[model samples]
Target: MSDPTTDPAFLRDPYPAYAALRSRCPVQQVPTGSGGHSSYLVTGFEEARDALADPRLSKNTAAFFAGKESGRRIHPAVAHTMLATDPPQHTRLRRLVTGSFTTRAVDELRPFIARTTDALLDRWPAGGPVDLVAELAVPLPVIVICELLGVPEPDRAEVRRWSGELFASGAPAVIDAASHSLADYMTGLIADKRSRPGNALLDRLIAARDGDDRLSEEELVSLGVLLLVAGHETTTNFLGNAVLSLLLHPAELQRLRQHPDEIPSALDELLRYDSPVSSATFRFTTEAVTLGGTHIPAGKPVLVAIGAANRDPARWPAPDTLDLDRSPAGHLSFGHGIHRCVGAPLAKAEADIALRKLLTRFPDLRLAVSTEHLVWRRTRLVRGLTALPVLASRT
Candidate 1:
């Protein structure tokens, strides 16, 4: 197979390529864009599921890339976040912050979410096209996360830039600078919280402990940095993708307009249909393992194609169809197993509120330009529209 990384068409619409690859075999070694290395891509639903939950597949970056210069690429400050660590560390980090997104906590934030959505919706000038991503998708999650993390209003914009620069596809030096910049910001933020704590999640993290096994200063900074970046990026993509998916399917949009209560299930379907995180972060094998009938050796980087697995025909009856009412029970959109996204509840709440309120407020919301003109993000990690200019109001 060709390098999917270099294909503009593949980047824009990768599902077709993912489907074609899955048809051949679920587990195939693909060329890594970096240094002639090969990584296994798991495309089948069953295979992806198994890969995500497998203990033999490790999340420790250093453990997998030991003795290789590849490990040095990551900024050491944020390298030890829960997403990059295995159990014990992962379990400890997750426990401290998991309560912040419990069902009750997310429910409590509904009023704030509604208020923020309304405030954003009120800014769109009638009869002029608005870039939905700039005015809405990006700000909503950023503001929510900032409020939750006690990020002062002045620093939020810088935080956003750092997060985007770290994730966006660009020059290596620029990306590395952004990574360290954001990590340094987090280090200072944690110290400030230490001096004067508040009720935000970051403050709680500072005080989190389990039988005297408290987080270290480094762990605190890494956790804050992780939350700052991961917290809003995925949701921003999800909101943009969800809106675009609806606008592309007018009938479905009409259905949502008619039954606003269906927004919950619709969000799930939207998530499965076009997961914000197209491909999950890499996992490396700890031992020889067989997946989808292919034998894989140790230390090989493995990628679970979350979007492909969600659309696997073997798993879903009509995989391509965007059926809002379809049950999205086992979708890997929020991932699976111990490392599943801790912010799933918060993400769902944000999408549900954003979509329902936007649709209700702007019944005529439609694309300002042709679908072909909409620019999709080129980053391999996240799948979303870069900008969604829309004629949101009726003439």
Candidate 2:
């Protein structure tokens, strides 16, 4: 039998497979596509929510692989990020950077985001076909994240290249190379910031202090890499996914164009309908525990299927349908618990501005090709279109 998680069909649309698995059991042991190790897959809505916040599940990747023979080589800075650490350390790291991503801070970027959106749209030719993913979706967030991190204009393109390679799942060599390149770049960037401090977020992070506590050199480098890569990657895919969803559902697209005020609230339903992040990062069982009546042994890896849980029938009636008005308050797209995405507010704000501007500027914007021609990226961590070609009347 093929592994549903890695199968090509599953990569295109994992929901049906997830539904099949959820019918049998919410939590089941499955192969990790790694050295004979099996991980517990959590698919049901409630089960996934509980598992995300479960203290018994550990996120310390370094400790988990300390003695285990692993095939891939990961840089120390990449491996020891807050995403891979447990509390006390995680708490400190999160606190040091939390203020930068607050609602107010993201709000301050609204004018800039709008300006960026207009500039990108301005480049589209009159009544021409454009690849939205390349022209708008990719560059908008990349520029925003790069500017926020103090990356000089000349080097932004290289930074994006390294970040893309880092997410090349199953390609260990590429991932390893990208990790080292990005970490080294960030280490140098941090050093430069120290010598010539500016008002960028990276500068604030470098100067951040808490009761005499300060982020270590290693932590700063790791956090910088994490923020730069994660800051834009998820939102880039999100813009592509969200735009595709809207194009496929014309009524929703028209409705949003007719009433732009609803764009902010409608984003949640769009996120839940087709999540950008298919699965949450890996979590390991610290002790044997029963989730959804399945017994998972200690030290086993666990994967929470965010895409599956968001569409679970029990969670929302007509879960497969895209109802813009549906109250999608509890969706796990940004995840739950302490490790939830710190940049959720920023992602939402970017989507709101991007979608509204795109729809309003090009009222006739639409898909340029048939739905069958659209391709999805083949990666376990994220679900996004490789390209989204659309027709728009440039005004």
Candidate 3:
């Protein structure tokens, strides 16, 4: 198969490449532009799940190139985050933030979530031609994350803008600069929060720190920023994708409009049919491990293709078809095993509420432009349309 990374057709729509990978190799070693090459892509459902759960497959990218210095070039601070750690440390880091993400915690904020949704929707112009992304997708998560973190009202826009730049399609220079600026911006916020603690997540995290036992000053700041960026940005893509999907399938939109309770089921199909997270966070191998039918050498980076795995025919009866009623139990959109999304329940709640409300309010919603004319997010890890213009007049 061709390299999906650089292929324009695959970039336009990756399902074909994913399907090809699942059928042809299931697990294939591919080259990366990041100096080092030969990381395994687990395309099959069974193999992806197994690999995700395997303790032997380390999360530490540094371990992938123990001897070769060039291969392990990612920053140290980047490696320290929960996304890049293994066991013991990963457990501790995750524990510190997990309590805040529990169902009860998220449930308590439902009213707030709804309020935010309503507030953004209120801004939508009545009738034709509205950019769903800026009007809805952008504000909902920004407000939610700000409320969660106790980010002050004044700083919210800057934070949101920075986060957008950090995630939006861009050149390497643009991305790197955005990342550094974001980290620095979070550091400043952490300092300010420390001075006058508030009822937000940053304050709570700082208060939660017990002696030298809890997350370090750096970790706390990084975690706060990660939650802000990852927690909000990915969901933005999801909401955008959901809106795009529903716009494409008006029958599905009408179905959701009438039977609101089928939303959870519809979301399942939305997630599987066009998942937000294109690939799992990068994983590195400790020892040379054989996956799918291929042997990967020790010290190489691997990315589990969550998008591909979700559509593997071996797992779903008819992988290409969208079945809203299909059981959502084993979908890997939130991923599987240890590193599954910590804020998944919260994300689901937000999306479900937002989507159902959207369809119910605007039953005649349809894309204002052709799918071919729609520009998609480029360079970002998440797959989403740049803007989804919709006409909502029930004529």
Tens-digit lDDT track of model 1 for 220-295: 7888899888899999999999988899999999999999998998888899999998888879999999999999
Reference-based TM-score of each model: 0.96, 0.97, 0.93
Tens digits of per-residue lDDT, candidate 3, 1-395, equal: 33444555666688987887677888887766554555678888888888888787888755554576552222344345678778887898888788878999999989989888877777777896899888888778888888888888898788887777764442545556666776777778878887888888778788766345488876776787788877787788889988887767767777788899988767778888888888887777778888877887876667788888888888888887766767756878887898989988788889988987787677778889888778767642677777888887532
Query: Taking the candidates one at a time, how many backbone clashes does each contain?
Result: 0, 0, 1
Predicted candidate 2, C-alpha RMSD? 1.6
Cα deviation of 307, candidate 3, in Å: 0.7
Question: What C-alpha lDDT values do all the predictions have?
Answer: 0.87, 0.88, 0.77
User: How does model 3 score by TM-score?
Assistant: 0.93
TM-score ranking from best to worst? Answer: 2, 1, 3
Q: What is the lDDT of residue 261 in candidate 2?
A: 98
Task: Report model 2's TM-score to 2 decimal places.
Answer: 0.97
The reply for model 2, stretches above 4 Å from the true place, is 1-6, 209-213
List the candidate 1 regions with Cα displacement exceeding 4 Å.
1-3, 71-73, 209-213
